[model samples]
Target: MAITSANQLELLQTAEAVAREKMIDPELVIEAMEESLARAAKSRYGTEMDIRVSIDRKTGRATFTRIRTVVADEELENYQAELTVEQAKQYLSDPKIGDEIRDEVPPVEMGRIAAQSAKQVILQKVREAERDRQYEEFKDRAGTIINGVVKREEYGNVIVDIGRGEGILRRNEKIGRESYRNGDRIRCYIKDVRREARGPQIFLSRTAPEFMAELFKMEVPEIYDGIIEIKAVARDPGSRAKIAVVSYDGSIDPVGACVGMRGSRVQAVVNELQGEKIDIIPWNEDVPTFLVNALQPAEVSKVVLDEEAERIEVVVPDEQLSLAIGRRGQNVRLASQLTGLDIDIMTEEEESARRQKEFEERTQLFMDTLDLDEFFAQLLVAEGFTNLEEVAYVEVDELLVIDGVDEDTAAELQARARDHIDEMNRKALERAKELGVEQSLIDFEGLTPQMIEALAEDGVKTLEDFATCADWELAGGWTTVNGERVKDDGVLEKFDVSLGEAQDMVMTARIQLGWVDPAELESDEEAEDEDAVDTEEAGA
Candidate 1:
């Protein structure tokens, strides 16, 4: 075989045909051919020589050239491909280092072995070009829905022939008990696209919450038009799901729009999801109100939300408890997911008992801490005095408002409360010092003596140690691990310090230690505020 006139035109034709088959640019295939030819030429014309090849786009003529570079005397390592600057003077009037010299070379004859090697190189290049094309085509299509044909099953995973590429549907990503045979038409969410050593991997999913949102977008015109937006989605996949939607238009009801007339829109999505039951709820800015809507078909008697803890307590009538909790607690679980909160559901009777218990505990705390009689402590608890600190720091008028308490009696009560608190503080300070707490940490201004003792107990004895602590370390929080809520205990959590307060105190300590610049911090906060405002506006 040889690069003669008879086969020169065939090179361009072959490149065009292969490019058309792979849905890639013909120029890429031509470039691959040029390199393969160059490789073959190098094999015939001493492998040490830098040989190059170029094919004319219109004429399809293969041109071969030999190239050598003039380099410094010390850097001329390749005898055939590089020459010293002094040695290059024979070919040019003045040749400088880094100059490339080229001379036309005769194309090499391709023997059986050379032709075989050339063929393998072309095939490898074509395969790589095809992979690059496929990756480029599918990378932008992630987080979308696509239709494909089931190709085969491997180890409980389904492979789909998604036009131009194969997508893998992992066993765990499929709807429960869903099975597919060859050539079955399947619609799936493009969960991810990745370029790997073997090739590009397209991961498909049928259980993603985004799949339901996309289905609703396909079914409802309002959602497609952006008049109605899906604020949140929670799914048990193939069983039950909840979607929260809000409407930008006051005239349009988001839930009604998603549910469609006679449930047609929702029914279509349900059919596609293999009969997954869906609860369409209206979105609300108020988290508790939204949670009440999320746990539908079960009436809520009361809703108590602890914003700092991101926890909510829902009280329902005893008869509705089962309904609110659902079968296997699925209803409350989905509600928690939709609202992004930890939910504690209780019956009205249970809530009453819990409140009574709390009242008794507070009454006891006041009784023991203030040295007051049971009736007096109960009266203080009834007046919203839960702790000695409140009684100690409150105005005299507040204590006087309690029944059977005159000005003198109120004065004596406050005096007793203050003295008890002072004694406790003194004892806590002594204990903290004994535990090796530094004065710098004790004098940090926001922490009480009890808080200082707790910090010392946690090995945070210095101001630097306290500054290095994360906000969550000082404010207890709930974390999700393996799909279950886990509690993280904070040393200062018992002092009722919120996450914001912890952050403020930590930043203050950093500033005091010159670890942080307040002016820079102010600028960063201002920029963050602007970004948040921009994000909210874009989401709107």
Candidate 2:
């Protein structure tokens, strides 16, 4: 079983032949063998010994040698003893002190153990080299789509042979509701190219957001050229997706380009995605507009923003509510992500009610106080001034500047207008507090403590005030403190208070006084009159 000189030659030739067949460099194979020998020698011999392996490329011969120091003291037995001058001459002619000599030691015959050890080293080195090469080849391919053949399925992940290396297609990365078979040609995006002990760990993904982006880039020339940018994209994978596109040129429409003629361009991408619906929205600098577009196939009437809350209320038609919200709210949800807004979809009915309430409140404020005509009242309402505070805070000079009012009229109206506005505001604050409206709600209009107290005493405390008092009573009554009149009909007339304002004041007053029971007020007035008469007669 010993490897004679002839046997070593045959082994080296066999290794060379295998290297040629495998397209591996022979010198690398020899180096691997030498490294293996060094490892084996180190394992067998202690670190005190210097072991080296040498290989002759031309002859295909290899040798191992152990170098030792000549020491005066023999504490380390591995070090040969210092020889006398005459004894050194026997091995080296004219040897001097500290001189080293090389002696040809007989080659050790390596049996089955050495052969097995060398084979292991060669295989390990070859594998390591192959891994390093594969890592180098694939590292630059990240973020690109590559075609591969499905190799097999393991643990719900498809293994793909990407020519140079194998790539993993995780179950989650595969397009949902789609199937593939072994040997099927498929395209995937290279998510990552990682180095491992075996080889390059190429990760393939079919569900990455970049996959859609890349598809767009391929289908839209403007996108690749950077003329039209895909600002944002969101997807529900196989169901639907939304992409926001912006163009550098103001005249050019990014959405139109992406959609192509008859949607041929987007259709191409859609086909790739297995018939998934794609919505290409024109990106807008204004978030509200962008969000409206993001929620496609549904017309948006308005967008109410709650910036601090990061929420948006979108008003659409009753029929379009379901469409705007989409199945399971997918449309708005995706739109929210695409436009970076938290969207709440509302039907036209809800929106109409809200607008009607707002309009009534605004109209009441204007008609109740301001001397302006209906045209002016409507203008103020349109301008979003629906409360006394807005009018009270408006500068008199500005009011005078408004069309149809001269400086003299402006000054006179300004004083009375301000006083009326202040009185209404004060009454509203008091009414708000009296009606048990939370301090938080009261503060919504920036009402101060004094204003709240005044409004409460005047019975104009909260939104509930109108529910308690009749409109005529509120308009006719005066707000007093300690039997002293603080406000009267003159004050109310000064601002031309409208029916809505009168109603609100009355409701607020009733709520503040806590005297008007909603149940009684809500009951039939005739029945209450009969009951009162019967009680009076009984007492008599």
Worst 10 residues of 2 by lDDT: 485-494
Task: Tell me the deviation in Å of residue 329 in model 1.
Answer: 1.5
lDDT of 1 by residue, 281-330 (tens): 99999998999999998999999999878889999999999999999999
User: How many backbone overlaps does candidate 2 show?
Assistant: 25
Model 1 regions lying over 4 Å from their true place: 72-74, 84-94, 459-465, 510-540
Tell me the lDDT of model 2 at 349. 93
In the order shown, the candidates' Cα RMSDs to the true structure are: 2.4, 21.3
Q: What local distance difference test score does each model get?
A: 0.93, 0.73
Q: How do the predictions measure up, each by TM-score?
A: 0.93, 0.60
TM-score of 2: 0.60
